[model samples]
Target: MKQPNPERTPILLGQIDTDNHIATTVSLFVILLVVHRIGISVYRLYFHPLRKFPGPRYLAATELPYLYRNHLKGDWVRDMVGLHRKYGPVVRIAPNRLALDGSIGWPQVFAHRGANQDEYAKVRGFLFPGDHEAIIAAPRDVHRRQRRQLAHAFSDGALIEHEPLICHYVSLLVQQLAKRAENNELIDIVKWLNFTTFDIIGDLTFGESFHSLDNSEYHPWVLTIFETIKGSAMGRFFAAYPIVRPLVVLSMGADRIKKLQEHQIFSKEKARARMAAGAEPGRRDFMTYMLRDTRSGEKGLTTNEIEMNSPILITAGSETTATALSGFFFYLVQTPSAYDYLTKEIRSAFRNEDEINLRSTSSLQYLQGCIEETLRCYPPSAETPPRVSPGGEIDGRYVSSGTILSVYQWSTFRNPQNFRDPDSFRPERWLPTSHPLHDVRFDNDNRSAFKPFSAGTRDCIGKKLAYSEMRLIISRILFRFDYEIAESQDDWHTSQLVFVIWDKGPLKIKLKPRTMTE
Candidate 1:
């Protein structure tokens, strides 16, 4: 063996200082642990902190289940209910989150603002992240200002003025259906409903519609939005982590950002032109109302500002309405008796599609019930929107601030505690005067339990308009032709692409012409 070099050994020993390496490694780990611990503590004890309350373990800790379930599974809403059933009224879901399936009331929860707008603001689909004062993204004061400005357009008089406009589309829908029946082509009710809705909304709000009704397929943006929603639902799952979002957003494709920028630009330009005219559009529409109102106010919302919010209004107003219509028609086909009954009522009520105006459609009580039952069974949006607790006692239960809470229309509507034989489709359940469904708990009361259009300040702003559109469209369709689900059954239980979900596949139906013989 060669003699050892003492100097070399000492030099090597300098490199082997474990104390410094160990300290560096340990310090890095400690820092990571501290950061992680603080984050966890915030979610668990502060952010939507419901230490004493309960829900599914995964849900309480984060929106992972709520976000993932709808996108990932068909029975998402039901699964939450299942969790509710298993865990009781309040269940701790995540490290600190809670899901409360309250029965008596949850009014204050829906209305009050929590910690900040973070409760609902987490739902970014309403508007993009921006400094602009869009109605949905604006601070409370700005939202109030914007909403007040928008009120002129959604007013009853505005609605009546627009009655002819809506009626025109209803006729156009009838004509399109006639062509389909004549061609012996099967109808994808989902496509047409959205087509009509997008068209109507576009026309009524944006001064024009894509005229999707005339197309054999959906418009590109319609397809894009549907994808965006589905994408968002999936994104929401990862968003629960909070740390993952920045990395994901940075990696987003240039095309998506470009498209969003394009849409924003288009909305801005259109709104400016409308505002510059200093007159509402000649046609009765949302922009028209907005234009008229902007004149009265000293200052106007920037074009970009209105643009940010306009899409949301059209989306929220029509997408939900259209989904409700598609689902309603889907269920009606199964319930032939109810279908026949509604057909008889509408046909007897009106002579032609032209005769079926918004005012006329409003008179049909059974129609209203049919719409309600469909909404109750297959709510437009998969969920009622989650919120953070307002930090107070609601219905005698004390909830601290930052509690992640959601009021589910899906669960509330299907709940046996609220409705009799809740799963069954029963339109008569909502008859005005006398029905077996009546009870002190919900029915015969002004703000009752069967609220498909929720209640109070947070209630749907487009309720009346949605009601008019569904009634007229469905009424005319059912009256003119009868629809039956095809050999391949239509399924409403699909992974929700958007918060406002539709069936996985088209609602394929054989539309048979209704005549005296039939």
Candidate 2:
């Protein structure tokens, strides 16, 4: 400061002035950003195209409301039900999204995928990373192509060949449950069902069994699948705010990302191996169709398609089936009379465990009714599968192109308008009108609204397989052992947190072998 050089004085002052200007610029920019955000929010609330839509003021303005209800609280399904109850079928869930219910929503959004009509495509956000390449995520045309190649494998005829694989694993499950019964043990039916279904899909898709039932422990990859889904469910929260994607990924932490990467790598390796093996002529598995795809011309799946879709198959095949079985058993143990009726139906229908097969089990009417009721009560898709409206009318309202529409399965299934006494476990509703057991009161419920597997072209591909697996596993267990809700788990259904799928808690049940000799 003493005797500062004359030449340096101007430079120092210039530096100070530049720093002040930068500070002022940054402050002004931040203020502008705040103002812009406030303005946009106001517009969204009162002046956006979706302004007239019925919804909470906060949700209509920002995603924060739905995120708070779904991601933060884990009561998203319940919250949606409440919302629809308050706001009617068409409620604006976000600034650009509407959740629809009733008969028209299904046919219009999911079913109307013709060249001449509005094809509300799959919401890309709901699917995996592969965009149109992933089967569940694939666009309409890509889905049609991919589905063509894979359709053979999931076909009723193909599943007949795959039945041996299912039966083989279900046999192992029976053996394990029989062991548990002998020990008079309290077993988590959900965990065991997961093990069975995972093993079957592992074998069917990957061309090898996870051997989880054989080992009595989940495969490391299976554990990874569960972890990945949890992360994905959480990731969906941040996905609602696309601007924060990178920040959300960073916040999800490195360990989670690494784990998800591991899952992908693991799946890739299995799929690659299966592809290398090629189809074994008559081998009837998921890989077989893809392996022979080149010969199928237009219907063939590419190597990349096969690799990505195998995991999707495993997930769609295994998780949903296990959820249905677990949910059925959960309701079964709670409703004593329904439980008694179903047990009688299954045991009486089959003389022995060996007598039950895919074809034979279909005749068990009461068992089928129970399965239907379970699907209605606790569907595999606990949340809505969001669809997009590409500028068309839906539920009597014209929606702009890219407007999101979702008919939440949980709310639609449970809505009083859809079903009478929707909360109660009543299998009688599913019984045919010709059946003496059928109820007119139950019949009065809008039967058309109960679409657990969903509807239209995008409906579940593995539906038949799912039904077969559920029927076989449930029938086997009921025949061999009598089960009751374990004392520790009360109100387990309400306690479950809904992710995209259910983060199902253990369904603890106490099993006792039926008196075979008596």
Candidate 3:
């Protein structure tokens, strides 16, 4: 071998030095990253503002545990029930978040603000795209404006005008169930309820029906709506972990994403078409009321605002009513005493099916009680949208600014402190003490805690409409047919996964036409 050259030796030494520098940099970088994480965790555990609150230390140290359990696992509603039981009314669920039971928490956190107080801002991360424009996700001032404009459509006077249209669809529902009853078929009551409610809301919002009830099957768009709602949980998860969103999107597949986009497009197009058609005189559809304000040159929603809000109105009006009714029947048929009592109440109250209108149905005390209990047990909007604190007290505990809190509806309604025999379905629990049906055991139950539609200025505006729909539909169905649970679907209600809204499967039942004795 030739003698080593001076230049070659220098180059080899230089290469070794460069490798050593790269290794040292990477080692230092990794060490810093680990140290940073540890420092943050320690801060969260020992020095965070929420450190005094009771909760799993891991959850308080990192949001990962809460996000993993609630969002990824789709078990937040069920999990909250256990969490509140273990940690009491106030629990630190994340480093910056607390879950409040609805009793004192609902009033303190969600009640109307005082003169000097600012509204607790909504947690933006919980919303889906386009939701910011809708009343549900609008900023405080924006929400007030939107609510004012939209309030007329849901007014008592407006609902009176819409009654005939509502009755028409309900009649169609009864007729459809009659056919299924004649066949002795196992009817998926959930699907039928969905069809009825979707058609009603579609007609009210679009000035056209989805024809789901007429077709005796779901419209493609209606099917897509359910898919979109289920996918919202995953969307919320991605929103929380934006760094992982790109990877999650890739795994979600293009078809699913495309379907969601198509649903949005469909809603936008329908809204546009409704706008172009112009309002029909004496027509009381939702658009007609919105157009009235716009045409009168009042501070009403813009054309774009109308389009943005149509999907919100449709989903809010339809899915929630359908869910409540589904839960109503699920609990009703299983509780034979409740079933018999309600059926008697309905039959005795109405001599002819035609007489069972919204007005007549409202007077059925037991029916009303049953509906109330159903709402308590299985609220349509089962989870509360998280609200950000503005550095105030909640349930007598001080919450720092930017802290996230929510009165989890599932936990509140099911809490033993709020109700007697909380897990059991007892309509009497909702009756007043003076009522013959009222149970003494539930006398001390925290009745104020039973806010299924929520409370305060931001409460659900469509509450009156929802109650009317549920009462009319359930009373009519029970009056027309005698039904039984087709299969042992005891877990049908509880087995669902909450994705903002419930991801409910089929509720199967068999119906027999009740003989009319004039």
Each candidate structure's count of clashing pairs: 14, 0, 0
What's the alpha carbon RMSD for model 3? 2.4
The candidate scoring highest on lDDT is 3
Q: What residue runs in model 1 are displaced by over 4 Å at the alpha carbon?
A: 1-49, 57-76, 102-106, 111-127, 137-139, 234-266, 293-297, 434-447, 494-504, 516-518
**Where does candidate 3 stray beyond 4 Å?**
1-20, 250-254, 280-282, 294-297
Candidate 3 residues 1-518, lDDT tens each? 88999879989999999999999999999999999999999999999999999999998989987776666567877888898999899999999999889997668877888768888878773745867677887888788888888898899998898999999999999999999899999999999999999999998887789999999999988887887775666677777788997776687654555667778899899888888877663566888766665435774777777887898899999999999999999998879999988898899888898999989998888898999989888888888788888998876778999998878788899999899889888999877777788888888999888888777788889999999999999989989899888667989977887876778989999999999862
Determine the C-alpha RMSD for candidate 1 after optimal superposition of all C-alphas.
4.6
Query: Which lDDT value does model 2 have at 89?
Result: 88
Worst 10 residues of 2 by lDDT: 291-300
lDDT of 2 at 106: 77
* Per-residue lDDT of candidate 1, residues 205-298 (tens digit): 7777777877756776666565455444445555465676556456654454455555555556655665665554466567655555355556
Q: What is the per-residue lDDT of model 2 for residues 1-518, given as tens digits with 9 covering 90 to 100?
A: 58989999999999999999999999999999999989999999988888988989888878787775675356777788898889998999988989888455776777746688757877774645664687787877888877777888889888888888889999999999989888889899999999999999998886789989999999999888877776665666767666866775676565665676788899899889887877773566788877674453553777898888887888889998999999998888888989888888877777788998998998888889999999988998876568777898766777889887878888888899889999899999888888778888976788787778888887788899999999999988888888888786777888888776788988888898997542
Judging by TM-score against the true structure, name the best candidate: 3
lDDT minimum window of 10 residues, candidate 1: 118-127
Question: With candidate 1 superimposed using the best TM-score fit, by how many Å does residue 343's alpha carbon deviate from the native?
Answer: 1.8
Identify the superior model by lDDT, candidate 2 or candidate 3.
3
Model 2: residues with Cα > 4 Å off, grouped in runs: 1-27, 68-73, 240-253, 294-299
